[model samples]
Target: MNEIDILKKIASNLTERKSTAALSNYEVLCNNIAFSHDLFEKGIVYLEFIIDHLKSIFNDRLSLKGDFRENECLHPFISVIPSLLLNDLEVIKKLSAYTPPDNRHGITIDNVSLLHRGFMNYNNLATATRQLIDSLVTDSYQLQLLDPKEFNYHVLLSLNSFEKYATKSIRQGLFNQEIEDALLEFRKLNFKDWKNSSITKCQHITFSNKVDHLFTNLNLVASEDIKFKNEINNLFKFSSEFTHIGYISTFFTSQAGSQVVFGSEKSPYLPSTENFSELKYQILETCINFIHKVYLPSLSSCVSKIFSSSQELVIEKHISNLVSLLKEGIKTRNNSYYFFVCSSLIGSQRIIDLPCLCGHLNKWRPPHSNSDLFCTGCGSSYNILAIEGDPGYIITGNGPVKVIGSEAPDFQDLPKEKQQEMLIKVAEFNANGSGN
Candidate 1:
């Protein structure tokens, strides 16, 4: 049977089971399907069931008003809506278009206000979904799936649907032209270039810049509370760094081979496939958590702060929420020892030059180098040894030197005099005839 049919059967069977094991399996199956394809309505049904099943897990009775109020509910609900089938799209589109003021059919203003707050909660889901889609499509280094052509086709199809819904809901289009242009450009993108490109760079910069503008606008509206302005600015700066530069730098370092900056006066090395994959997963999780737990909450609270009266309780609540989110984010960062472990694993790939280090030029060298010369390719010095009665010199090294990879120091950027001076230093060092 197709995935949908199977999910339907599982959902049907779930209603018949009273056992916790069966319910847990149903939840896992639902989550897995939700993770893969958001279009699955059956997955949604299953999730609703899971929520009801787990209702007792919550404490405060007021907090148990609905499945949506729980923070944990946000991730799963957001996950399932995007890949949902076209027929099911209307339900999600309706959810997105929900506005509180209209909900009471022109009744009391208090009811309208309550509905508006309800809409905000739903809007958070939409924003979360958009963020998740962006994350999945633009992984670290901005690489799409191994097959860009296939991924772009899917993205284009989704963009068309997105535009239609956006136009209908917003009463005006925002991303229609931008989405079309991006799709067109995507078609022409070279896979290699896309792989190397920093997908987060432009988006991160835009978001960071937007935060600055947001603060500026807020400062104009906010009362002349210097302390409040300062706090908001600090929060903006922290969010900008967390989203843009800090996370990107961590991801780039994890992916772009090792560095010589830490521990044991040794050079950095390329990471193993497993090590790189693990780090990549950790970085991805960190980014996802930051967006969900930190960025979204901060933006939502800031919006409320900007619009609502400056009641001390409301202000304190928002500020406390921001602080709590940041603390959680900080705690998630891996310890220094983890970084050292990753670096040590990376260092094992260092290159060791042989013959050139021993003052012998007659020995055969690797194809990238000639004779017993120092190999610029791998950043290692070799030596050539003329063993008694040997037909030719043997090439060897005192120890393995770390490979510098493609981003080694650029000699071409240096002035000619400086370049010559560096070469002279290298020559003198080699003439001294010591591996040390």
Candidate 2:
């Protein structure tokens, strides 16, 4: 039948159920397409920022592996984002970001194999998922359009198979020997009797469930986006049975269920937190989760070598912000969480310029020795050592000025009485502005 005949048949079928004409299942699916791009764009902004942050820190230190540059951490992110073409995804660089050291280096916190393993897992999963999505859009759409009279149900079968494939790979990716060995044994049987097995009793879990499992294993957790969770669960159920459509004449007429609504009722003109696609959000979050579990902690490990309470707090807060951003999206941006690095983590030494009058600064010589101090603001030099007994007070044109500088070794080694005598002399110099 032509398009008009198809519409008439849909209308006739809906009328029989006493329902108004509604979007077919495929229409609902198509309407949700915008969810993918908008959400992925926002997600990429954060991912790029994160990659840049890692590059700024570890890129210089990583070793080049083959043609893959040591510092290039964008491979995984690029692998996921929408691609024009990706035929060779299987052979793509998945471990380039994880080059090992040249020598037999002991695996310290700074060089944890798990950290690199996290990146490799992330890259590999994204590669597989991207390829599957490409097939979903290209092959699935083509198969569906071959003829309305005979759309391929096998495409939907492949879709079901691919989701389960991803779910299984994710389970294996955990790298837990116990879990791996158990899953390995199960796979050997082709999961023929998996339903009777102790581990899950044959129930298939959604992506969010796998993520939760990962977090539980790692002793870290993130809040789930309920809508995202539901969408993924629902998506897997879209075509659960391979023989479903063969028995239903309504399959072509109702792509999704009849009661389902497509798109949103909200006005587009208003500024709102962009709604991300469930698939895109999870994919993006997977990348962020890897960073959270491995990259940030590795950075923290390197940073903690130096003892600084403020720096530690700052870095921890930074890590927390990143996790929140990934889970909550731009909602976490209100507090400037997107910054790659914060100044507080730098723990820089603060210096007061000492207000030079002629824009000139030079080390002043004391009669006793060269203090290597540069505190003179006026044309005449002041006896700064007078403040050793009291760094809290310095005599000057502005009366008493408190000056604290890094300890002057020469002055620190002097006798207390001598220092006091010098203080008295400085007091006299302040009183006359000429007596040293």
Candidate 3:
């Protein structure tokens, strides 16, 4: 059956017998799906923001006066976001297909298999979310701090560090002799003295290193809070279980009352189903906070650092939306959710039907100061550019949606520099023919 039909079939049966846990799998799945569903929307905006800002930076710097390393540094980030997003959507889909063990069958072998798959998917989701955290916070730190050559080299070393694992893997005949010979040849060809090169011995700057350097690079108030590091470390520790174990999260589309089957380890006391929902929510909340409290500030600083030589605001125009969103988030986070309606008290509202990309009319009144304009229809809010006589325009991140798969091939699959070459080719082709 098709995925939607399968999901419908699965979700159409959440009703339960008396033997299940305190919360029925139906209710537990509902809460988790609802949480992840909301997160999916937030995650999209967050990823889009990153890609959009990256687009601004890439397009602006792609034509720089000198050095190919600038583009090289950017290449890793291009594929990573799209890949994570694909995983995110998939996790939610799998979760939607979730159902608890049918106690009516007394936890049969089939039910055990079902539960095992559910938890496994949950772990995968956790790991993917953790990876997303790095893409947003840790990766942004590198972009804003390191020079292009240094950053690109770090990524290269990380990607090409198969030598160490292979050479000393301790797994008997992990690689065939032919592959072994190829690896040796590859290292010899690339690194003249693979055995003695100091650069080869050096470790890439890790997420913790990036976090450590975040404050040193920029003097933000949260720099001294110490909680960002603690939270991120804790998040990694939690996801490490799932990342290695390969278990995990789910899709949001489900009907109430579906009988679900899940596997669990035998224990003195079974853990409550509520725990996963809370944990997933907490991780996502932490991700959002890191983006706002850490990445955005670091990114703004990076933009200035990067364009320090230029006089005009080449990339800031595109990035200002992110800063604006951060500002709005900080402004309203502590206050009431309905404070925006109260905002109309202080500033006059403009009734314009400037169409939003969400297919909703943007007739809502914006703040008099032209800060961030939030579309009520799609809830996609960003900084509204207030130009004279131009009723302001929406700069939807407008980053390439299919950069990895359909447009230029997956960046991860490409060899060093080939992704960049293919990307430019795709850009050129799309530019000439209007991306038909």
Candidate 4:
């Protein structure tokens, strides 16, 4: 069934069971749904702000010069946010499907399964949120400091993780010899110094030697207090448990009601009402904080850093204006105006590479949707077909000049130096176009 239908079914059944446990699940379910929707809506708002700002800064830089060097750095991180947001949505859906194991009969097994799924979804949601925060910070570094040592460290950790897991699977007979040999060959160069060490050596180095580096890289890596290290450790520890053992342990334990169902003593176990409620509320709070405190602020910083190179003061002014509008909107209850102003301020400029006459690349999302064009900065709309035309005019000394498509230029028509410069610009634009 669809998510809406499932939500409706839960709501209808909530009233049927007035027992304390059943009532608590209903309340928690309602809260979970509400919290998820709030994040989803806010994510939409933040995403619009982020993408529009990226486009604006890109086009603004494009207008001043033919070569925009920073575009490549912005693409990878900007492309990461939407998928993370999608992960949040999926977690929300699972939370909505979960029901308390109050009726320990025909529905008990399904409810238990749903609860386990919710835990797994929450783990994924948390991971994605953390990664999004990290990516934004990396984006900021690319713009301001241009240091990539930490970025490469993350890359090494990721590759090492894959190698470690692949080797483990091979040992467990989960991968054939050919696959094992391929993985070993891929790791050969990386393993030169630590030839006898386990493949997880990089992972160990990241956690043990790079804690300070991580904190320095991103404010969200840990809490901004004395207990930051503890918080980071705890977060990773809990996430690991949730990912590997928590779901399976749920079936074997009788201590609490938080979504486990396996046991030899299987006399239809369920967590205590209080314990179950606690777990549910904890997940809700984490999701909300991740969105409000971690994700949005880091994303804003990333955008500001990328655009601040040429017009730092102007970027700050626009952000201040957006904050003021948001406060006023909250006071006057004009959410539409607030969001519009936010979009206008952030997306004041359009992407240099997109093909819309308004010169704005508006709302290109929901991958399957054919109708993803609606400009908030300018009251103009276009379809995917519009992408074929020239990008909007750029401010030039002579006046605003329309940008000719990069393809319009013949490479050999220019001096050798200019030709090389043109090739670099085209390559940068293509990288930005891919945005990943």
Candidate 5:
């Protein structure tokens, strides 16, 4: 049957209360239109019309089941329609002020509650769509329009809180010294068992699946937008260098008993913490722009074509309100969460050391030494067996300063005295350096 005729028949069935036949027709319509973007958009309009009609018919009749399925014929129709409506409503609410006049229009709370049990069904549907999109991207479906670079960038940005927290932990010395030492122990762990660890395996599987899905979608839409294609290609290059090659190099170097050189010559695109933060901000801005300039407008245009001309203003206003709300929501939500996580990870500990001008007797040690005799606070090295008892040494390198144990005082019980002595030494070092 023609689309208009089929829609008319479905509406008639609803009016006549022929639930069985109406549902069957609805199911057929839904199934046929499910994959076609154009058909899906039209179907939503038809469903919205049917919902309004049903509300008008049964508004005073309290006998109808509260479930969406009672009025809708198909299972998927009942399941999906409420969410679409709610999603539409949420976008509207977000875009527009819940001011009294606008609030007075559209479905009332009482009706909405009775229809979908108080919860907006659209959120569930949007979540489902997100999941489906994720799955499609992971499966490498060429027909999908998603860009993995943009998608991954979004996901990483979403996890900004996690990254911030991790960095904070490093800066604050929050980790136990023993835990830091455990790196040596971790190296000795069996490779077979380590490789098969649940976390590692799961991460590998998830990443691989996502990459596959992303590539498939990329291939399908490669010809649609040259800019998008170029972005995707750059993203792939970054991922290859940052994740694949960088990870391999780190693993081998760490295993080889050497420091892993991160963000090195081989992986030029791998961002440092500062770089990652900046890139994340840029990506978020770009996504927001894309959504505002491209996605929302395109969807609105399609919606306008399907709906009544008179309703255009209302729909457009609703969409604008929603886009604004989403932008604000993302910013507020991410900022607060990111700050909390990062602060927790990187505490407020300040590291202080003696300046070079201090002429305090300073003991020095070779750049590479294994001893707990270094006082990080004063940048002094101590030797217990010096002829004068304890000889203090000061670091004199352009790199990070380290304390040597030989220069530290043996007066453990005289904490105040030891601090006073260190201050005097610092004064002398400073004076001598100033003269030169």
Candidate 6:
């Protein structure tokens, strides 16, 4: 129907349902649509940023419109975001809101409960999608200022999270019916059937067989978006590089030297401004194409399938506010990420036993030697070493020991008196085998 007619129908429907719970259902459905729309807005901001960044880089280089070198840099984020967004939309579609037209066809308690389950799945997908969009924004900024190659690693991790949620949603949808059927099969039994046991077994067997049939038919329920499906298939193939060693792995690794060359001697590897401009062009093209052709449809389809035209009109009333809130949220959440890696030699470390305050011997180890050295016996957070008495070293059998590991804090790091006090306590503990 035309826009005017659709609005009229929506108005009529709302007036007709003024006193009915369908109005409330429509309201709730609009909220869910708004929530998904908020994520879409955030994602759009990232895409626009990438597009703008590309324009700035390539605006001066019209001569290099079609250069293809270094295009690999743009591939990960380009394919990853759209694929993940499409998957998220599909999960949302599974929970399409239902409002029966008449009393005879109204939603049942079971349907309401099932819808709740679907909402839970959609909520998880939405959160994970937001995290990915946030990561992409952060990565995009970092790419400009730091290592551009790090973008792929961040995208790969986000893809892992997105895939994890998508798999969970699929499993939840797939097994929900089987679980209900299994319960129904159990309920349809008498005392005699229970005593027979074989009847119960047969029921379970039938349910198992049906599950197999459902698995075979699952492909029929797959997303109708061919590009989405193709992207998902391609994504899964390339995602393995993050988990295993291969070519994509090398994309993030530092080169041996700037002088290293590849391919022909005549062409001897050198960075060109044209190639860089082409890379920017590729980024721009991919982001624009995906945003228009893939992301917009996916978001529109999600909202379209879940809400009626009347409810959509209601959502439109708040679209401006949603967009503003999305912008505020993105601005607040745009912060740099700091991460640390442990490269110390873990093999040479000795597992020192220390007494816990709780009178357990397995509790404390010196700081930073092993983070995982919690007490398994007493469940204490760490092993506590209790040192008592005068500020002098109590001699061990072989010698006076001040510290254990070289990585341990320097004795001079503490005040001279405090260092002597700690050493005396350690020596006392060594001599008596107990501080308390």
Per-residue C-alpha lDDT of model 5 across residues 128-243, encoded as one tens digit per residue:
33332233233222112222233333333334334355776563565565534543344454556443432222222344344444434334345544464344434434434433
In angstroms, how far off is 298's CA in candidate 1? 4.2
Between prediction 1 and prediction 6, which has the larger lDDT? 6
Poorest 10 consecutive residues by lDDT, candidate 4:
334-343
The numbered model that scores best in lDDT is 3
Model 4 CA deviation exceeding 4 Å by range:
1-40, 63-146, 156-224, 227-232, 246-274, 290-294, 309-436
The residue-by-residue lDDT of candidate 3 on 1-436, one tens digit each, is 8999987855554332223343433333333344334333433444354444444544455433343225554444444434433444444344323322212234454443332223554665676765666556545665565454454444445445754665455434555675455455445644644423533322235667666677556554364457667778678767766666632222211212333344433211122333344455465556656655666566566555444345226445434443444333333332221111222233455454444433345554545444435666546664432223321111112111221112334333545344333333333333243331
After superposition, the stretches of candidate 2 with alpha carbons farther than 4 Å from their true spots are 1-18, 21-40, 52-59, 62-209, 218-232, 239-322, 326-436
- Candidate 1 local lDDT, 182-219, one digit each (tens): 76665465545443342211322233333443344334
Question: Best TM-score goes to which candidate?
Answer: 3
Q: Could you tell me the TM-score of candidate 5?
A: 0.23
lDDT of 4 by residue, 1-436 (tens): 9999987875555434322233343333333444343333333333344344445555454322222244564344334434444544454344434422223234345555433333444455445434433343333333333233443444444555765656554556655566456456546645454422333223224342333433454454544532554444455455556456554345323222344343211223333433454544454444343334333444445445444345544444444333332222222221121011112222234432333322233444323143444555445453332223343332211111234333334323445454333333322332233210
CA displacement after TM-score superposition, residue 109 of candidate 5 (Å) = 54
* Clash pairs for candidate 6: 363-382, 363-383, 364-383, 364-384
Query: What is the lDDT of every predicted structure here?
Result: 0.32, 0.33, 0.44, 0.39, 0.32, 0.33
State the local distance difference test value for candidate 5. Answer: 0.32
What lDDT score is found at residue 389 in candidate 1? 29
lDDT of 2 by residue, 1-436 (tens): 8999998986776456433332233222222332222223322333344334434433333221322233344222222222211221221122112111112125343333221212223234344444333333232222112221112222223333554657656745644575345445545543454344433241213344443433343444445544443443343333222123322335333333223122222211100111112332344443333434533444344334321454445444444444443334322211211111122222234432333222234332223232433334324343333222324334332112334443333432555454434433333343343411
Comparing 5 with 6 on lDDT, the higher-scoring candidate is 6
Q: Which has the higher TM-score value, candidate number 3 or candidate number 5? A: 3
Error of 2 at 333 (Å): 12
TM-score of each: 0.20, 0.25, 0.45, 0.40, 0.23, 0.21
- Candidate 1 at 176: error in angstroms? 18
Compute the lDDT of residue 205 as modeled in candidate 2.
Answer: 31
Which is the winner by TM-score between candidate 1 and candidate 2?
A: 2
Cα deviation of 333 in candidate 4 (Å)? 15
